[model samples]
Target: MQGHRPSQKQLYDHFAPKMLGVCYRYARTLQEAEDFLQEAFITVFRKLDQYRNEGPLGKWIYRIVINTCINGIRARCRFSDTAGRIDVEHLENESTAHPAAHSEIIELVRQLPTVYMTVFNLHAVEGYPHEDIAKMLDTNVNTVRSQYSRARTLLMKKLGSGPKTNENGKRG
Candidate 1:
Protein backbone atom coordinates (compact mmCIF):
# COMPACT_ATOMS: atom_id res chain seq x y z
CA MET A 1 0.00 0.00 0.00
CA GLN A 2 2.86 2.34 0.70
CA GLY A 3 5.37 1.53 -1.98
CA HIS A 4 4.83 -0.55 -5.09
CA ARG A 5 1.30 -0.78 -6.39
CA PRO A 6 -0.53 -4.10 -6.15
CA SER A 7 -3.21 -5.53 -8.46
CA GLN A 8 -6.95 -5.14 -7.92
CA LYS A 9 -7.46 -8.82 -7.34
CA GLN A 10 -4.61 -8.76 -4.92
CA LEU A 11 -6.12 -5.83 -3.13
CA TYR A 12 -9.56 -7.41 -3.09
CA ASP A 13 -8.24 -10.67 -1.81
CA HIS A 14 -6.21 -9.06 0.90
CA PHE A 15 -8.70 -6.52 2.23
CA ALA A 16 -12.23 -7.36 1.08
CA PRO A 17 -13.11 -9.41 4.15
CA LYS A 18 -12.04 -6.74 6.62
CA MET A 19 -13.62 -3.92 4.64
CA LEU A 20 -16.87 -5.80 4.28
CA GLY A 21 -17.12 -5.88 8.04
CA VAL A 22 -16.69 -2.13 8.04
CA CYS A 23 -19.22 -1.68 5.24
CA TYR A 24 -21.69 -3.82 7.14
CA ARG A 25 -21.42 -1.58 10.19
CA TYR A 26 -23.59 1.24 8.82
CA ALA A 27 -24.95 0.07 5.50
CA ARG A 28 -28.63 -0.82 5.43
CA THR A 29 -28.21 -4.30 3.99
CA LEU A 30 -25.63 -6.86 2.99
CA GLN A 31 -25.97 -5.87 -0.64
CA GLU A 32 -25.66 -2.25 0.32
CA ALA A 33 -22.54 -3.06 2.24
CA GLU A 34 -21.17 -4.86 -0.84
CA ASP A 35 -22.16 -1.88 -2.92
CA PHE A 36 -20.28 0.34 -0.53
CA LEU A 37 -17.27 -1.89 -0.98
CA GLN A 38 -17.46 -1.62 -4.74
CA GLU A 39 -18.07 2.09 -4.57
CA ALA A 40 -15.18 2.48 -2.18
CA PHE A 41 -12.99 0.37 -4.43
CA ILE A 42 -14.02 2.29 -7.53
CA THR A 43 -13.49 5.60 -5.79
CA VAL A 44 -10.03 4.67 -4.57
CA PHE A 45 -9.05 3.00 -7.82
CA ARG A 46 -10.10 5.99 -9.84
CA LYS A 47 -8.96 8.73 -7.49
CA LEU A 48 -5.94 7.38 -5.64
CA ASP A 49 -3.80 5.86 -8.34
CA GLN A 50 -5.62 6.21 -11.67
CA TYR A 51 -4.09 2.95 -12.87
CA ARG A 52 -5.97 0.34 -14.87
CA ASN A 53 -5.73 -3.47 -14.85
CA GLU A 54 -7.86 -4.49 -17.88
CA GLY A 55 -10.08 -6.62 -15.66
CA PRO A 56 -13.68 -5.76 -14.76
CA LEU A 57 -13.44 -1.94 -14.99
CA GLY A 58 -9.99 -2.42 -16.46
CA LYS A 59 -6.65 -0.97 -15.38
CA TRP A 60 -7.97 1.95 -13.41
CA ILE A 61 -8.93 -0.38 -10.57
CA TYR A 62 -5.66 -1.17 -8.98
CA ARG A 63 -4.38 -1.27 -5.41
CA ILE A 64 -5.97 0.89 -2.65
CA VAL A 65 -7.83 -1.33 -0.26
CA ILE A 66 -7.05 0.39 3.01
CA ASN A 67 -7.72 4.03 3.85
CA THR A 68 -11.04 4.51 2.05
CA CYS A 69 -12.55 1.47 3.76
CA ILE A 70 -14.34 3.63 6.33
CA ASN A 71 -17.20 5.22 4.41
CA GLY A 72 -19.68 5.22 7.30
CA ILE A 73 -17.82 7.85 9.28
CA ARG A 74 -17.92 10.43 6.51
CA ALA A 75 -21.58 9.91 5.70
CA ARG A 76 -22.85 9.77 9.27
CA CYS A 77 -21.19 12.86 10.70
CA ARG A 78 -23.85 14.68 12.72
CA PHE A 79 -24.13 18.41 12.31
CA SER A 80 -26.23 21.13 13.92
CA ASP A 81 -27.84 23.80 11.80
CA THR A 82 -26.31 27.24 11.97
CA ALA A 83 -26.83 30.06 9.51
CA GLY A 84 -23.75 30.41 7.33
CA ARG A 85 -21.95 28.05 9.65
CA ILE A 86 -21.64 24.44 10.70
CA ASP A 87 -21.47 23.91 14.44
CA VAL A 88 -21.00 20.98 16.78
CA GLU A 89 -23.59 22.08 19.34
CA HIS A 90 -27.22 21.06 19.65
CA LEU A 91 -29.08 24.11 18.37
CA GLU A 92 -32.31 25.04 20.10
CA ASN A 93 -32.89 27.68 17.45
CA GLU A 94 -33.49 26.66 13.85
CA SER A 95 -32.40 29.08 11.15
CA THR A 96 -33.04 29.17 7.43
CA ALA A 97 -30.22 27.62 5.49
CA HIS A 98 -29.27 27.32 1.87
CA PRO A 99 -29.08 23.77 0.54
CA ALA A 100 -25.43 23.97 -0.42
CA ALA A 101 -23.07 26.20 1.51
CA HIS A 102 -19.98 25.63 -0.58
CA SER A 103 -18.19 28.73 0.64
CA GLU A 104 -18.76 27.93 4.28
CA ILE A 105 -17.40 24.43 3.83
CA ILE A 106 -14.45 25.75 1.89
CA GLU A 107 -13.80 28.23 4.66
CA LEU A 108 -13.68 25.39 7.14
CA VAL A 109 -11.32 23.46 4.92
CA ARG A 110 -9.14 26.53 4.64
CA GLN A 111 -9.16 27.01 8.37
CA LEU A 112 -7.58 23.58 8.98
CA PRO A 113 -4.11 23.75 10.45
CA THR A 114 -1.34 23.93 7.88
CA VAL A 115 -0.47 20.21 7.98
CA TYR A 116 -4.09 19.18 8.05
CA MET A 117 -5.03 21.57 5.28
CA THR A 118 -2.12 20.44 3.20
CA VAL A 119 -2.72 16.71 3.72
CA PHE A 120 -6.49 17.08 3.45
CA ASN A 121 -6.18 19.01 0.23
CA LEU A 122 -3.65 16.63 -1.20
CA HIS A 123 -5.63 13.52 -0.32
CA ALA A 124 -9.31 14.66 -0.48
CA VAL A 125 -8.96 17.42 -3.04
CA GLU A 126 -5.97 16.34 -5.10
CA GLY A 127 -6.70 12.60 -4.82
CA TYR A 128 -3.17 11.68 -3.90
CA PRO A 129 -2.53 8.40 -2.09
CA HIS A 130 -1.41 8.65 1.53
CA GLU A 131 1.97 7.33 0.49
CA ASP A 132 2.27 10.04 -2.10
CA ILE A 133 1.34 12.68 0.44
CA ALA A 134 3.82 11.18 2.87
CA LYS A 135 6.53 11.32 0.25
CA MET A 136 5.63 14.88 -0.57
CA LEU A 137 5.84 15.79 3.10
CA ASP A 138 9.00 13.81 3.81
CA THR A 139 7.17 11.78 6.42
CA ASN A 140 5.82 8.25 6.93
CA VAL A 141 2.43 7.08 5.70
CA ASN A 142 1.01 6.68 9.22
CA THR A 143 1.73 10.32 10.01
CA VAL A 144 0.01 11.39 6.82
CA ARG A 145 -2.93 9.13 7.63
CA SER A 146 -3.07 10.52 11.17
CA GLN A 147 -3.11 14.08 9.91
CA TYR A 148 -5.83 13.32 7.39
CA SER A 149 -7.86 11.52 10.03
CA ARG A 150 -7.49 14.40 12.44
CA ALA A 151 -8.43 16.82 9.68
CA ARG A 152 -11.63 14.91 8.99
CA THR A 153 -12.41 14.67 12.68
CA LEU A 154 -11.95 18.41 13.07
CA LEU A 155 -14.11 19.16 10.07
CA MET A 156 -16.82 16.86 11.38
CA LYS A 157 -16.59 18.55 14.77
CA LYS A 158 -16.99 21.93 13.10
CA LEU A 159 -19.79 20.87 10.76
CA GLY A 160 -22.19 23.22 12.53
CA SER A 161 -19.97 24.52 15.30
CA GLY A 162 -17.67 26.72 13.24
CA PRO A 163 -13.90 26.62 13.86
CA LYS A 164 -12.81 25.71 17.35
CA THR A 165 -9.34 25.03 18.60
CA ASN A 166 -8.35 21.36 18.74
CA GLU A 167 -7.65 20.86 22.45
CA ASN A 168 -4.95 18.35 21.58
CA GLY A 169 -3.11 20.37 18.96
CA LYS A 170 -2.33 23.76 17.46
CA ARG A 171 -5.19 26.13 16.56
CA GLY A 172 -6.92 25.37 13.28
Candidate 2:
Protein backbone atom coordinates (compact mmCIF):
# COMPACT_ATOMS: atom_id res chain seq x y z
CA MET A 1 0.00 0.00 0.00
CA GLN A 2 1.14 3.55 -0.75
CA GLY A 3 1.86 5.75 2.24
CA HIS A 4 0.21 9.12 2.71
CA ARG A 5 2.30 12.22 2.09
CA PRO A 6 3.63 13.65 5.31
CA SER A 7 3.03 17.37 5.85
CA GLN A 8 5.96 19.76 6.28
CA LYS A 9 5.08 20.54 9.91
CA GLN A 10 4.65 16.89 10.72
CA LEU A 11 7.90 15.91 9.11
CA TYR A 12 9.78 18.81 10.67
CA ASP A 13 8.48 18.06 14.15
CA HIS A 14 9.39 14.41 13.82
CA PHE A 15 12.79 14.68 12.17
CA ALA A 16 14.31 18.11 12.74
CA PRO A 17 15.89 17.45 16.14
CA LYS A 18 17.30 14.02 15.34
CA MET A 19 18.41 15.05 11.85
CA LEU A 20 20.06 18.13 13.27
CA GLY A 21 21.92 15.91 15.73
CA VAL A 22 23.10 13.81 12.78
CA CYS A 23 24.17 16.96 10.98
CA TYR A 24 25.97 18.24 14.08
CA ARG A 25 28.18 15.16 14.21
CA TYR A 26 29.56 15.94 10.72
CA ALA A 27 29.35 19.74 10.66
CA ARG A 28 32.14 21.84 12.15
CA THR A 29 29.72 24.10 13.99
CA LEU A 30 26.09 24.32 15.05
CA GLN A 31 25.41 26.97 12.42
CA GLU A 32 26.81 24.73 9.72
CA ALA A 33 24.65 21.88 10.97
CA GLU A 34 21.59 24.12 10.86
CA ASP A 35 22.35 25.13 7.31
CA PHE A 36 22.74 21.50 6.29
CA LEU A 37 19.57 20.61 8.14
CA GLN A 38 17.60 23.26 6.27
CA GLU A 39 18.96 22.14 2.92
CA ALA A 40 18.35 18.49 3.76
CA PHE A 41 14.75 19.12 4.77
CA ILE A 42 14.17 21.00 1.54
CA THR A 43 15.54 18.09 -0.43
CA VAL A 44 13.47 15.62 1.56
CA PHE A 45 10.31 17.62 1.00
CA ARG A 46 10.96 17.82 -2.71
CA LYS A 47 11.73 14.12 -2.94
CA LEU A 48 9.09 12.97 -0.48
CA ASP A 49 7.04 11.38 -3.23
CA GLN A 50 9.97 9.19 -4.16
CA TYR A 51 10.14 7.64 -0.69
CA ARG A 52 9.08 4.02 -0.73
CA ASN A 53 7.62 2.61 2.47
CA GLU A 54 10.01 -0.33 2.22
CA GLY A 55 12.05 1.38 4.93
CA PRO A 56 11.09 3.39 7.96
CA LEU A 57 10.62 7.16 7.62
CA GLY A 58 13.45 7.72 10.09
CA LYS A 59 15.88 5.84 7.87
CA TRP A 60 14.83 7.82 4.80
CA ILE A 61 15.32 11.07 6.70
CA TYR A 62 18.70 9.81 7.88
CA ARG A 63 19.83 9.15 4.29
CA ILE A 64 18.86 12.71 3.35
CA VAL A 65 20.81 14.09 6.33
CA ILE A 66 23.85 11.95 5.50
CA ASN A 67 23.81 13.09 1.88
CA THR A 68 23.50 16.68 2.98
CA CYS A 69 26.49 16.32 5.32
CA ILE A 70 28.53 14.65 2.56
CA ASN A 71 27.75 17.51 0.16
CA GLY A 72 28.92 20.06 2.70
CA ILE A 73 32.11 18.11 3.35
CA ARG A 74 32.84 17.78 -0.37
CA ALA A 75 32.39 21.50 -0.96
CA ARG A 76 34.90 22.49 1.74
CA CYS A 77 37.21 19.53 1.21
CA ARG A 78 38.00 20.34 -2.42
CA PHE A 79 40.54 22.91 -1.23
CA SER A 80 41.53 21.53 2.16
CA ASP A 81 44.16 18.84 2.73
CA THR A 82 44.23 19.69 6.45
CA ALA A 83 41.25 17.47 7.20
CA GLY A 84 43.17 14.31 6.38
CA ARG A 85 45.71 14.72 9.17
CA ILE A 86 44.95 13.52 12.68
CA ASP A 87 46.28 15.70 15.48
CA VAL A 88 46.35 13.35 18.44
CA GLU A 89 47.50 15.98 20.91
CA HIS A 90 44.36 18.01 20.48
CA LEU A 91 42.15 15.16 21.68
CA GLU A 92 41.20 14.69 25.34
CA ASN A 93 42.39 11.54 27.16
CA GLU A 94 39.05 11.13 28.96
CA SER A 95 37.05 10.80 25.76
CA THR A 96 38.46 7.34 25.09
CA ALA A 97 37.09 5.80 28.28
CA HIS A 98 34.03 8.00 28.59
CA PRO A 99 31.52 7.82 25.79
CA ALA A 100 29.76 10.84 27.28
CA ALA A 101 32.61 13.06 26.15
CA HIS A 102 30.94 13.93 22.87
CA SER A 103 32.57 17.29 22.24
CA GLU A 104 36.08 15.87 22.11
CA ILE A 105 35.05 13.00 19.85
CA ILE A 106 33.11 15.36 17.62
CA GLU A 107 36.15 17.57 17.17
CA LEU A 108 38.30 14.58 16.25
CA VAL A 109 35.68 13.30 13.80
CA ARG A 110 35.61 16.71 12.14
CA GLN A 111 39.31 16.44 11.38
CA LEU A 112 38.83 13.33 9.24
CA PRO A 113 38.89 13.60 5.45
CA THR A 114 35.64 13.98 3.56
CA VAL A 115 35.51 10.39 2.37
CA TYR A 116 36.46 8.99 5.76
CA MET A 117 34.05 11.28 7.59
CA THR A 118 31.10 10.22 5.43
CA VAL A 119 31.90 6.54 5.76
CA PHE A 120 32.61 6.70 9.49
CA ASN A 121 29.57 8.76 10.25
CA LEU A 122 27.32 6.44 8.25
CA HIS A 123 28.81 3.22 9.50
CA ALA A 124 29.84 3.99 13.07
CA VAL A 125 27.55 6.79 14.11
CA GLU A 126 24.49 6.13 11.97
CA GLY A 127 24.85 2.34 12.08
CA TYR A 128 24.54 1.69 8.35
CA PRO A 129 26.13 -1.44 6.89
CA HIS A 130 29.20 -1.28 4.68
CA GLU A 131 27.18 -2.63 1.75
CA ASP A 132 24.64 0.15 2.12
CA ILE A 133 27.37 2.78 2.42
CA ALA A 134 29.14 1.43 -0.66
CA LYS A 135 25.90 1.57 -2.61
CA MET A 136 25.21 5.11 -1.45
CA LEU A 137 28.73 6.37 -2.20
CA ASP A 138 29.11 4.35 -5.43
CA THR A 139 32.11 2.54 -4.05
CA ASN A 140 32.87 -1.07 -3.15
CA VAL A 141 32.22 -2.58 0.28
CA ASN A 142 35.93 -3.18 0.79
CA THR A 143 36.61 0.52 0.34
CA VAL A 144 33.99 1.33 2.93
CA ARG A 145 35.43 -1.25 5.32
CA SER A 146 38.95 0.13 4.88
CA GLN A 147 37.84 3.70 5.43
CA TYR A 148 35.96 2.72 8.59
CA SER A 149 39.00 0.93 9.92
CA ARG A 150 41.17 3.95 9.18
CA ALA A 151 38.75 6.26 10.93
CA ARG A 152 38.61 4.00 13.99
CA THR A 153 42.39 3.78 14.17
CA LEU A 154 42.67 7.55 14.04
CA LEU A 155 40.05 7.88 16.78
CA MET A 156 41.77 5.36 19.03
CA LYS A 157 45.11 7.08 18.62
CA LYS A 158 43.67 10.50 19.24
CA LEU A 159 41.60 9.51 22.25
CA GLY A 160 44.32 7.40 23.94
CA SER A 161 43.78 4.63 26.44
CA GLY A 162 43.34 5.34 30.12
CA PRO A 163 45.09 3.51 32.96
CA LYS A 164 44.59 -0.22 32.58
CA THR A 165 42.99 -2.31 35.30
CA ASN A 166 43.21 -6.09 35.48
CA GLU A 167 40.18 -8.37 35.88
CA ASN A 168 40.75 -8.89 39.61
CA GLY A 169 40.74 -5.23 40.66
CA LYS A 170 44.50 -4.94 40.18
CA ARG A 171 46.10 -2.07 38.28
CA GLY A 172 48.10 -3.09 35.25
Question: Top TM-score: which candidate number?
Answer: 2
Candidate 1, residues 37-100, lDDT tens digits: the string is 7887767645644444445432233223223423332354322121112232222122225435
Structural similarity to truth (TM-score) of each candidate: 0.38, 0.67
Name the weakest run of 10 consecutive residues (lDDT summed) in model 1: 79-88
| Model 2, span 1-172: residue lDDT tens | 1234456878788889988988988887899999999999888888888988988989998888888887887677642222212333334445565767867678778777667777777876678899998877767788777777766666665666433447894657
Candidate achieving the largest lDDT: 2
Residue 10's lDDT in candidate 2: 80
lDDT of 2: 0.73
Q: What is the C-alpha RMSD of each candidate to the true structure, in Å?
A: 14.7, 8.3
TM-score of 2: 0.67
